[model samples]
Target chain A: MAAATESFTDQAIEVAGLKVRVMQGGRGSPVVVLHHSTGGPGWIPLFERLSAQHTVVAPDMPGYGQSERPEWAREPRDLAILMNAAIDRLGLTGVTLVGLGFGGFVAAEMATMNPSRLKALVLVGAPGLQPEEGEIADQMMVDYEDYVKAGFRDEAAYTAVFGETAAQDIKTLWDFSREMTARLTWKPYMFNRRLAPLLKEVRTPTLIVWGEKDAVVPPACGRQYKRALPNARLEVVAGAGHLVELEEADRVAKLIAAHAAQA
Target chain B: MFIGYFTERPYQDPSSGYFGATGRDLTDLGMSNASYDPRLGAELYNRYLDEKVYAEEMGFDGLMLNEHHSTPFCMGGVMNVEAAILARITKKAKIVLLGNVLPIWDDPLWLAEELAEIDMISRGRLVTGWVRGTGRESVAHNAQPPFNWERFQEAHDFVVAAWTRPGPFRWEGEHYNYRYVNPWSRPYQQPHPPIWIPGVMSRNTVAWAAKHRYPYVMLATELEPTRQSYQYYDDQAKENGYESGTQNRGYLFKVHVDETEELAEAAARKYIQGPSNPFLEGNQGNVRPFIQNLPGLTSRTNLLPTVQSFALAASRGRLKEHEAATGKKAEAATASADKQDAADFLGTFTDQINKMSIITGTPKTVIPKVRHVLEYLRPGSIFFWDGDGAMTHEDSMRSLRLMGEEVIPAVREMGKSLDLSSPFEVDPRTNQPVA
Candidate 1:
């Protein structure tokens, strides 16, 4: 079956000098869901859950989803600034930042770039911090379905893309992911050696999550992340895959809540 | 867990992450000092053991290990031997040898003996995997490369022969020779630890697995292609050619979980897309030997163009020889082919290299996605690939612990009629099965 992911509501907002589309939901302490290349509109369920208590805002990065691609922010750090501006434009003061995939890179930047601005940071299935050699070898691919099929704990991500579903979510995820290729493919994924050291500068209390069976970024790489962030915590979702938070929503929510409460 | 999942080429220096020193590739030949000194390899193996032990201590049900050579990605170039050392490491967790490259390794028999020894050592916690390997890998060591699929079939038999035989064994074969082919330390598990073979172009492998009722692990080359392999196995079983349910088929791929899609995308950017390796796209030519395996295999396929380019990376002094040997007719034919096959899908051999699965998100969002795969790939067990660069140690732990505590439970609750009894049937662990 053709695997698919459901998308989320799309809203565009101009932040700083650039205009970006955001798929936002919920209301309360703001928690931003930064999507990877698969792009959002494929709103994750966790946001829905968090929306009950916290304002869960997911923005399709500049190149993906509802967000307009900005010419200025080419690197992740640049993307982080754009994210901060989006937060500011929405009038979000102290926000809990959570990023997945490439979004995690943004979260990492957010945490250290301006520690005071972000209340807490959560990096889910993030890559590129500790250059752990020869473990994680999941090849990033061409289409959205490949994202899930390549090895998501939620096989539905892949099947949903092909099967009959809420066209809205699938379309959003598809469109956003397609838009992201402009930047993600601007430079192929996974090989930049410069950013690893920058991660050390990130001082925000962070939580990194990974799929134990994550083929894309091996768990070992996740473990290396533990060493990079001084006030960071790591969790390997067992059985659940690359999308640990999606696979194990309750636990992820609990961790998010716990970390947020404590941090 | 089948065996080991290696990065393309890893850094073996002590400074590198993933606890290095053992990662050096001895066979690489290109390095001023290639091949981790077997003793140093042993030391790094100790680190591996330490890591394996930690895997068990981390509430994991199994310890994962594998082999690789000439590259730092995976050290167990020879998994059989690695298994022997692992046998003494831990008793609580299952031992998985994601695989041994049977086609390249000269002796699958010795591999079997080592497998038994390790199985006995683990007191039955052993799982074996076989693979034809990516095309580039086969050409590195084995005499027959690209078209060696036929030879792999033969080598597979000898290995299995050594494993299944009840007593002393003697075999005469085109590739291997052995007189005393018996396990002194028979495996603790009945019928030897489970066997798992995951890869592309393994129709014959699947048929063999079915005949023996062994579970097969399938991380299909691609999502769509996976269906074809699934059908092949199903048809084989329908014909009563192989075991059906009990003969587990564990599928694998990438997964990213997060509370929201946006969060996932963010993580994907850093962990997956942020670093963006510039080397993977286009004619990255990672495989030349595999192409050289068959002068003909190189011709018609889109991969040959890149193969023509990558053969040099081997660093073997003779690549120039191959380049020199390119006759005028071949060049002329290639030039003529370029014109004729203008629209042809070549040049960018690594196109399939990027943008595959990259699951990033929260468990709730990820569970259903996993269930979807269970129904599709139908793997008895599962494996995950972590992005290198180590997102952050603390963050990673939090994520992993959450994965174990949260994700597994949710997925199990979704229970589709899957057979957990099959050898390949097990829960996902850290690149290893949690038994």
Candidate 2:
């Protein structure tokens, strides 16, 4: 409805009395990307690939990036409500949903809470269930330097998160994102005990994408997601960590695009 | 003036040491469980308990106890239990639990029951205190650090309601919930026992104490900061439309006495190994900062400056030690900076006592210094810690006897001369708000 570049258009929308910043681009079917817990950096290279084929809609989750955090959205379910309202407000039906890390948890909640509108669901290195053997790395507790190091497959990919500008404001935004993520995920600690049972209600075609070496959420969690969901397939990307989408953007994007094409 | 006696009830015998085997410091969290030899611990607990019971006979108005987790520096893994034991063991002295760690408790109602029972048994002699435990406690309990303050506030509210308000009421707060919010036991004190809060000058805690009219106890913190923190509490109380006095404030310090100054200094030096060394050894990667101050635990702006000050203080102490060891005197221009750094690291126990107003002398010399600190701070109560580190039970008993005969009476006279009356002495709770 507003002026847009061929590649992308950045704007804001009000849903549930909170200002939610969203980046929209390209032309065709609508596909939304739910971001990770440590948010704020939007329109990454992977989103650029998705923009070439589909009308990609990436809304910065409330309390991260440029979005406002209303008091009601303190819990994970509150986030699911905001996502549902955002999707319904955008007038998008039968849409493909993409989630990464903290975003994956929110997307799964959205599917379970309101299963009618989603056409396809894609989860990348998502953290929502616990494993019997290995523990999900307590991402919230590590020091700053260790946190950055553990997020990527190779240390070189750290620049992708900081971006070329690498200003103090980016660090501040990242800190806020961490705080908001803690508010939502600290109690259940990155996994919901009830989430496994609720996955049975997710009837939409689903894709569970995992990194070969995800330290934050173990690859075993992806297997659990696949087994729990009624209609889902697991795909593992080689030589990447928890942020698989950022580390191997081209391949990860292609996989999601192919899934969207099938839908 | 009300006087209280305290000891950390430390397990200091290192013959069967856990930290030494792990190559970690005495305060290391990893060595917590194994730090104490149970046979020695059983003996130490009884000895300490006997010492506290004797202190009641020594004219101390209150007997103070504290809680800590995963460290031999304090064996108050559960201090309320000690309070319960003391409630029946002693008759006259107020059984002061200063206090239960609020955030670590899974259920606030259980705490209400414990406190109520203590009050009922002690026949209204319970001075209930509450605290937000150290980051180490949070780690030991695996409690969420981000919710520490929130849980503390919620649990406090719930416990107070359970004690005072008629129950069968439901609670649905952010951190706690109850379907049947009621406990059968009620406290012996009308409404509830006097709530006291002890802190090293955390601004929010001090301010909250002021708002609720809870006596704020400054524990072994530096003199100047304690002064500033007391002023902050007073200022906050004024803003809330109330007047605060000496009774509203309390101060704790290490006070050792003997026949001569040499004996007193010799005993006080033992504290260097316990509380002083831990501050110098620093965090030592034992408990991560993230585990201590989680994101969203406090207002963001306050977190960084507080953390920076703590780091700066620790480094400054190390720098001073380095200078002293190498005989490298700082230049005149940098001397002021060094002094500022030294001032920042004030929690080191020996430095706090020696530099602040920790009186270590015979009653003749000690009285004047005690008078000076009391005159300057004008607090409602003073807690004299007679035992820590390698100090034996016999040594602690002698100090208690000396305090009973000489120190307490002299300090009372000095407080009277200075016209320093405590809030309890004034009894402001019954007075209606000024119209």
TM-score for each of the candidates: 0.45, 0.86
Accuracy of chain B in candidate 1 (TM-score): 0.66
Q: lDDT per residue, candidate 2, A9-60, as tens digits? A: 8899999889999889877788899987778465678877788888899998
Per-residue error (Å), model 2, residue A189: 1.5
Candidate 1 regions exceeding 4 Å error are A1-263, B1-64, B81-86, B135-137, B240-243, B256-356, B387-396, B416-435
The iRMS of model 1 comes to 15.2
The DockQ leader among the candidates is 2
Residue-by-residue lDDT tens digits, candidate 1, A108-169: 76665677778788888776554465533323222234545555655575454345333545
Pairs of residues clashing in candidate 2:
B247-B422, B247-B423
lDDT of 1 by residue, B1-435 (tens): 221222211233443222222343322223333424566555655555554455455445544454545444455566666566667766666666666767677767666767777777767878777766543354346333323454566777876666667768788776577777775666676645666666544346666655555556654234444555556666776676433552355555555444566755554443322112212222211222323232112212122122222232121222333333321112233334323122122323223323244455677766766666666655545654433222333334444555566765555554334533334444221123345
> After superposition, which runs of candidate 2 have C-alpha atoms over 4 Å from their true positions?
A1-9, A26-28, A154-170, B13-22, B25-28, B32-36, B142-147, B166-182, B258-263, B272-287, B301-343, B346-354, B357-365, B389-395, B430-435
